[model samples]
Target chain A: MHSLKDRTAIIGVGATPQGKLPGSTQLSLAVDAFKAALDDSGLEKDDIDGLLTFPGTTAPEGPLNYLRVGEALGIDPAFTGSMAMGGGTAGALVQMAAMAVESGHATAVACVFGDAAKTGGSRFNRASGWGDSWGIWGMMGAAANSAVAASRHMALYGTTSEQLAEVAVACRRHASMNPNAVMRDPITIADHQASRFIVEPLHLLDCCLISDGGVCIIVTSAERAKDAKQPRVLISGMGQAYTTRTLEREDWWYVPHQKEALDRAYAMAGLGPQHIDVAQLYDNFTISVLLWLEHAGFCKPGESGPFVEGGRIQLGGELPVNTAGGNLSESYMEGWLHIVEGVRQLRGQGGERQVQGAETCLVTGRGMTLNCSNAMVLTKGEA
Target chain B: MSDHPKPLPEISDETRPFWDGTRNQQLVMQQCARCRHIRYPISRVCPECLEVGHEWVPLSGRGEVYSAIVFHQVYDKAFADDVPYNVSLVQLDEGPRMFSNVVGVPPSQVRVGDRVRVVFDPVTEEVTLPRFTPEDS
Candidate 1:
C-alpha cells in the first residue's frame, strides 16, 4: 500500500466562534476561518497553492467554492478541488493535500469546512428529496438512520441506553473546559437519560449539536513546515474506505469499512491502537463513538459498553477520547473539529484538557449513515 | 388527511419501474440479466457486471427486520401527526435490503430479527409507498 507517512505536516488550525450565529452565511464563516488558519501558519495567502473544501453549501455551486474562496483570499492555486464524502472529507482532505505536495503538484493546501445550520436551517432536511422514491423519505435523517444501527447494537450486543449516555456525558465534560464549545454546561448520565428521545435508543442528548461554525487546517511539506509559526504535527498516516451498500446490508451495525480504514491507517503509521496516546473519534451520534471504539480495536466487540463505563474516556482516563468535546458537545463542524483537536493535542496546545505527555493521536471521521469513513494518525514533529 | 409534507422522490426513467411496481403493490428490483445480480434504487447499469441489460423482477417481499428505529422528532410538518413512527431496514430473503416503515404493531414493539412482509401504503394518488408489517399480522 502507498504511504504518505511524515511527508506532509499540519502547521495551523482555526475555527470560527461556534453556535447559533444568527446572520452568518457559510461563506463568511469559511472565509473567517481560512484567514485565521493562514495567519496561524505564518504564511501569506500567496503561499497557499492548493485549496480543498467539502460539497453542499460550501461546494463550487455555493458561494464558498474553491474559486470564490481563492478570490476572497487572493490566492491563485495550482490545485483546487472539493471532496463530498460527507463528514469524512476532513480526514481525506489531509491525505489529498499530502499526496498533492508529495508529488510536487502544490506546496501548501488549505482545507476548510463550515456551515450555518442553526441560522440558515439544515440543508439536509430540504435536500433529501432523492430519498422519497428510495423509500427512505420520512426516515432519512442522520439521527433516525443511526438510531436503527443503535437499536440493532442493543438487541445483538446488549448495549444499553446507559452505556450510550456515557459518551454524551464524557463529551459534555470535555466541552465544559473548552471556551468555544456550544453545549458547555456539563451533563451527567442521568441528564442524558432524562433527555427526550429523538429516535428510540437515541436520546436527544446522544445527537450532535447542529450549530453555525467553520474549521480550517493548513497542510504543507514537512520541510516547509519547519519555519511554521506553531509546533508542526506530522500527518503520519491516513486511509479511507466506503461501504457501498450503506444501511442496506444485513449487518449494517458492524461497519466493516471503518475497521478496514483504521487497519490501513495503522499500517501506514506503523502503530496500533495500543500506541495511540489520545483519540478524537468522530461522534456524530454517541453510538458512533461506541462503534468506532470497538471497530478501531480499542476494545473487543460487544465490550465497548463496559469499556466506556465510569468516565474512562474522559480527559484523565485511559484513552481520553474526544478531548476537545467532539461533535456531541463541542461545536459541530461536521468532523472538521476532530482533526483540529487532534492537531492541538499533538502540538501540546491543549491547555486545560491536555493529556500529560501526549505524543501520537488518532482521529477519525464517520460520514453519512456510516457509509464513508476515514482515519488519520498524527504525531508531534521535531521542532 | 393532509399529505406528507416531506419531499418526495422525483421519478425518472431509471427509477420509474421501481415506483411503478410499488404503486401496483409489488416489490421489484433490477436483476442484472448478465451477472444475475440484484440491485436496488433502480440503476441504469449493473454495478457488478457493468451490464445495461436488466429485468425488473418481483421479489418475495418477505424478510427479517435487520434494524429498526422509531422517530420521535418531527423533521417535517408532514410527519407531525405521525410522531413516533417506526422505520426499519428489512433484509429481504431474496438478498436486497430496503428502507420502509413498519406498521400493524406498536412502534416500541419492533425489534431486530422480527419477521416482516412488505405492504403498500397509497399516499398521494401518484405515489404508493412500500411499508412493512409483522409477518404474523
Candidate 2:
C-alpha cells in the first residue's frame, strides 16, 4: 500500500538493438533511443521536461546540449543532473525519474541512457587515490577486479570451471529465445572451458560482451499515463548502496550492507523477496549473477553455484532472470537491456521464453570495485 | 597499484604514520583510542564511534587470504608489460582489509583462506607497499 501504486507510472520504454553498431556514434544512438521512447509514448522530444544520464558515458552532457534536445523540442527541465555509480547508474536513473514525478517538479521525466561501449569505449575508473587506494595495480577494466572476486568464490566453495561454464550456457539459452540477444548460439560446457581465460577463475565466456546499444524510458503521473500505449508500470521502490568503492573494504569482494539497499526498495514498495516475478540482474560478469543472486535474497550467501546450477534461473524457473539475455548475452551498458526486458515481460511481449503472466520484476546492478550497487522493483503497470 | 615513474603517494600529516609503518615492516591497524573500536585506511574519525581520536596499533601479521585476483589484462601503459600479476585483499586477523598485491606465489596458486603474511616493497625514502606472501613460505 505504501508503494507508488498510483503515484507515478513508466509510460514508455525504448531501446536500440543489443549488439555492436559499428557505424553509430554515441550521440546518435542516445538521441535515437530518446526519440524512439517518446514516439512509443506518443509524446515528442519536446515532452521531456527533465533529463538524467551518466558523466562517465560516451554521450556526456554535451550531446544533449549540442542537439538542443530541450530548446529545439520546446521542453524546459526544472530538474536536471548526471549520475555515476559504475554499473548501478541505470537503476538510479529510473529511481530519479520516479522521484521527479512524485515531487511534482516535472510532469514528464525521461530517464535516458545509452552508450557505444562497443563502438567507442568505456572510460570508467575506481578509487580516488585516497590513502592506500590500489590505483597503482593499473587495472584498466573491470575484468581483473571481477576475476579476483570470482577466484575467492571458487576458493571458498570449491566452485569449478565447469560450473561457471553453466552460467554462460544458460544465459545463451535464454538469449537464443530472445531475438534481441547478441550471442544466441548455444555454447557447451566444453566450449566454455576451452574459451580463453582472461583472468584466473574467469574465462572469456565468463565476461560480458562489449556492444553498442541504447535504452530509454519516459515516466509520468499515473493520471496522465492513461493516454500512453501501455498501462502505467508503477514505480514501486528504488534504491542504491555502496559498501566501499575500494575492493579492500570487504573481507572478500562480498559486502555486508548490500541488503539494506534492496530492503529500502522493497520496504518502500510494500513488497518482499517472494513478490518478485522476474529478475533483470546486472551481469557485467558471470560471477556477478552468482554473487548478486545470493546477495539479493534469491539464495543464501555463497549458494549461487547451487542456485543457478539447478537451471532454475533459466526458462520455466520459479523466478525468471536475465530474460533479455542480460549483459552476458546482450549488450553490456549497466544492464540497460534488463530494464527493457522488464518492460517486455510486464507487457507480455516476451515471445517464447516469457514468464507466464509475469507482472512484477526486480532489477539489480553489480560489478564495480565493491559495495556499489543499484536495485529497483517494478510491476506490469495499470491499464 | 602502480610501479611506474609516475606520481607516488605523498604522505600528509594525517596519513604519514601509515605509509611510514609499512616501510618499517610492522603491521598496523588504526584505532580510535577513545571508543576502543578499530578504524582503517587512515581516517580522521572512528567509523564506529564517530570519535576523532585515531591511533595505530601493531598487529600479528597473520590473516586469511579473503580473496585474490590475478590480472592477466594490464590497464596502465607504464606497467602493461607486467601481465598476470596478482592483486588481492587480505583480511588481517585484527580486522580491516588492506588493498595489496599477493606475491611469492604463482597466479594460479592463490586461493581464499590460504594463510598469508605481510611483506613490504620499498617505494621511496618514506614509503613501502605492504604486499602479501603465502604464510607457508
Candidate 3:
C-alpha cells in the first residue's frame, strides 16, 4: 500500500524518427532516443544513474539487454535491469523508475524501448521455441490470440465489427494530426470493413503498424524535476498485474488482472475514470482498446460498444484516447510511444492534436496476449 | 495436408504423456490427485492445489469452442501455403482448455460455443497432434 504518488516526475521524453531506419541497429536506436531524451531534459549523459529496457526486441541482430545497452551507452548505472513482460514493459518501466527514485536507489533513470522490426525482420512473427510447448501453431500470430478475445466479446455482449471499426477510425483520425504517425490518412469505418482480414474479426487495419522506432523517457525525483527544461509530468500512481496462465486462461475475454491493475492505479491516484482528460491505452489491436476501456471502468462491461460510438473517444469528445495516435495508427514502439505521448499531452506539447488544458492522463501497457498488463496515472505538476 | 510444412510441437518430459495419449487416439490431461483439478499444456505441478502428485486422466474429448480465429496472413514461411487456417481454444468438459485447430469445416464458418470433439492427426511417426472437429461432423 505504499503510494508512488508525486514522488518522481518524467522530465524528458524522446523518440527516433518513427518509420524504417534501414541502417540503424536496435542498440543504436536506443542510444539515439536516450541521447535525445538527455538533450530534451537539459541533462548531460553523466546525470543518468539508472537504466532500464524491455528484453523483447524484434531485431535479430542486436542485444537489447540492459547491461549490453549500458555498455553501448557508456553509462554504468547504480541500478539497472530489463523487463521481459513484452508490451507491458513501458508502464512497468515507469513504475520501476519511480520506485528506484523514491527509495533513494537512484537519482535519475533512463528507460528506453527500441526495435528495428521493419528493417531487421520480425523474429516474433514465427512460432518456435517457447510456443512449441504450448501447441500454438506457426500460423497463430498475436492477431489470432486477440481475434479469439474479440470473437468471445461478440458472442457474449453482441459487440459488432462496426463498433471495433470505430476504434480504428478514431485512432487514424488522431494520427492524421500527428506528424510522427506512420499511418496518418483518415480512415472511415467503411475503409476498415474493406480492409482484408489478417485474422477473421481482426482486419489488417485493426492491427497495429509494424515500424522501426525507439522511444525513451527520463525520470527523476520530483524535486530535481523543478530545474528541468520542460514542464514536469509526475508519475502520480501506477500498478502492474499478470495472470498465471496466458491464452488458455478461463476468463480470456474479461482480462481480470488488467482490471485489478487499473483499480490499484485509480485508487493510488485518488481519481476515477471521470477525471481522466485523455488516455493512451495500449492498442496492439483495435479490439484491445475496447477491452481496456471496459476493464478499466471507463465504461460498463458490455457497454464499451456503445460508449466508443459517435466520436466519444475522439479529440473533441468525452475522453480523447490515444491523442498522439496509439500503436494502431501511430508508430509502434511496443507501447513505448504511448508513455511518451502521455508525457507530451501532460506537458502541453501535443501540437495539432493536443487535448486543450489536459490535466490528467492515463497510460497503459498490455502484453502476452492481454494476460499481462500495467496502468499508470500521470498528472501535470500537482494539478 | 501432405505438403504442409507447419512446425511441430516439441514434446518434453511433462508434455510427452499428453502427446502420447493423442497418438493412442485419446485426449489426456493432468488432474491433481489432491484437488481433482484438470489442467492442460502439461505442467510439473498442479496449479490449483500446488500438489506434485497427479494422474493422466483421459477426457471425453468433447467440448465447446470458447473462441476461434481464421488466420489469413502468413507468419512463417512454413505456413505460407496454409494461408487461411483456423486456430481455436476448446474448453473441455472436464474444466480445462487447449489450443487447437478446428478441422472438418471451413475456418470462417466456425462459431463460438459450437460443440467440438477431439481428433488426432499423426503427422510424423514420432508425433501426433490433437485437433478438433464439430461434434456431429
Ranking by TM-score: 3, 1, 2
Q: In candidate 2 chain A, what residue range of length 10 has the lowest lDDT sum?
A: A63-72
Where model 3 places Cα greater than 4 Å from the true spot, the runs are A55-64, A128-139, B1-4
Q: Cα deviation in Å at residue B77, candidate 1?
A: 1.3
lDDT of 1 at A31: 88
Candidate 3 CAPRI-style tier: medium
True contacts kept of each: 0.68, 0.53, 0.62
Go through the candidates in order and give each one's C-alpha lDDT.
0.84, 0.73, 0.84
Predicted complex 2: DockQ: 0.48
Please report how far candidate 3 places residue A364 from its true position, in Å.
0.3
First chain TM-score for all predictions:
0.95, 0.90, 0.95
> What tens-digit string does per-residue lDDT give for candidate 1 at A1-383?
56788889998899999999987877788889998888889998888899988743434366337776677778788998876777888888878988999999999999977777788767454322133443344675778767877888888889999999999999999999898899889988889889999988799999998889888899999998987799989988888888866534556557789988999889899999999999999998999999999888999988899899988999888989999899999988889999999988988888999998899999999786668898998989988
True-vs-predicted CA distance for residue A326, candidate 1, Å: 0.7
Provide the clashing-pair count of each candidate structure: 0, 8, 0
lDDT of 2 by residue, A178-269 (tens): 87778889888899988877767788899888778777778888778876777557667776777763533564366545676788778777
Docking class of 2: acceptable
Worst 10 residues of 1 chain A by lDDT: A126-135
Q: In candidate 2, residue A263 scores what lDDT?
A: 80
Q: Give the Cα error of residue A143 in candidate 1, in Å.
A: 1.1
